[model samples]
Target: MKRKNVKLMMLAALFPMLCWAAGEQPISLGTPTGEIQGRVMLPDVERPPVVLIIAGSGPTDMDGNSLLGAVTLKNNSLKLLAEGLARRGIASLRYDKRGIASSAAAGKEEKDLRFDDYVADARGWIELLSEDSRFSGIFVVGHSEGSLIGMLASEGNAKVKGFVSIAGAGHPAYEIIETQMSNQPAEVRQLVKNINDSLRAGKAVNDVPVGLMALYRPSVQPYLMSWYRYDPREVVACLEQPVLLVQGDKDIQVSVGDAEALKAAQPQAELHLIENMNHVLKSCDTVDAGVQQATYTNPDLPVVEELLNVIEKFIKP
Candidate 1:
């Protein structure tokens, strides 16, 4: 018997809901540790090349919701992106990072984790994909912190076709954090400095200002330490495979300079700088901090079609 393509074409419903893109049903990939849940959207015909989408930092869910409340991608980014790919005859896997969503089923807390543990979990996902007959080859798509996760997971995986970084940092994590801190008001800057000093002195930042707890939570120090050891530019420089570096020109949290740094590090990397796009890939009214926060929780906002088009072209069979 011939195998049918698992991809589903989502058109504007023949009439009523035709314009809105249809989403996919959730699925799971069982690993040694626990089951990781994700949604798979494939074209209605044949199975398409698959892409694995990883979420960014903080308490972000699979749908791109951050705990900050000030920011929300109105729509579930991973879910919508996957469904969009399916509409284009492509497939995608968007899973909650360990300690997030369905993966949280394991009861392991993010605060008690290390950076290497994430790399390991990513590797497990890769291994799962390789063993599954459904996918042809996987493209590792990492957003923000996930970009680093993808690079670390792809180190020697021949099954990984390429790597994509969306709003990824170009410098070391702490360096970027320090740069971000410098832009804060004087009081906040001083408090940030104190926390950094405490961390540098090998003391817990618990004694510092309450404002710094976001960065100093006890359960997350090991992961922070592991993340601090890596330089993103160097990692991209050393990658043996093709890379796609996408950044938003209007992103305040991550500057366009970061994108330039990545290009400088890997002259051959494909760079796409979208105008008016923010860190979350949504079109922005302005790049100002205040305006950006206002849209964080508005899931109705749509991502720039340009980004989806570029990604589709890159991952197509």
Candidate 2:
């Protein structure tokens, strides 16, 4: 009834400002902060399962690319995944982060965008999908930092039947930072640890080392402090539903060990490793650095069939 009317309005506006080509329709919904923009990609089949595609960190748009079309590493990974899912009769909704691209009006939340804000946005989108009668079930597919966001959003959410984590960080932010700082001087590592400790204890460190001011600056501390409280392993363990953790062997940003850690914490969650797949969801065979890096910019590359196959089975089943 109400859902049908909204769809009719969307359909009637086919000539005004909306484009519904191939079942992709622009959607805007009001939030407590502001309005968030997104695109709902629908399958031709009736009552298809709905999956919310949560994008990763930074100002990443609905397509897994940077906002305002920044030329650097503008890969259409998430966009391709939606198209791939549509081909298999699965529907998805992907959106720009607040203060990013079409969702710019939602910038009111960006300056103070703590990690929980992202989780709230994901939760809002999930509730929106539940309102639509054309969907059979709801699933959350989060990539990179979005994994944490989606996991937190699904806490006690009855509508979210399952979760798919793609290239998500396995350990907490502090541990990951420690691992990445292995090459830095021991003193630098120690300073980071002390700072992280203080923040974890709800104390802000006033004396940030000059060498590391860029990362530990006052402006970034609030968000960092909020994110420090979450441990991926701990969060995954608390989830009672079925979870799918996917990792690519060739990914440079997130390692296979991260996926393994999550699986270890939540033994119930099934883990799948895609051979030769990169972080961008592209299937790159070469071990050569040049070729592997090229995939980040290659928009035409089809998302790995194996990745799509696994997700389709997870949702449809």
Top lDDT hit: 2
Cα-based lDDT at residue 170, candidate 1 = 87
**Cα deviation of 97 in candidate 1 (Å)?**
1.4
Off by over 4 Å in 1: 1-23, 31-33, 69-74, 183-214
Give one digit per residue, the lDDT tens place, for model 2 in 72-143: 677899999999999999999999987788888887533376878788889999999999877888999999
**Candidate 1 lDDT tens digits, 14-35:** 3323422334657676655577
Worst window of 10 by summed lDDT in candidate 1: 1-10
RMSD of 2: 5.1
User: How does model 1 score by TM-score?
Assistant: 0.81
Q: Which stretches of candidate 2 lie over 4 Å from their true place?
A: 1-22, 67-70, 108-111, 286-289
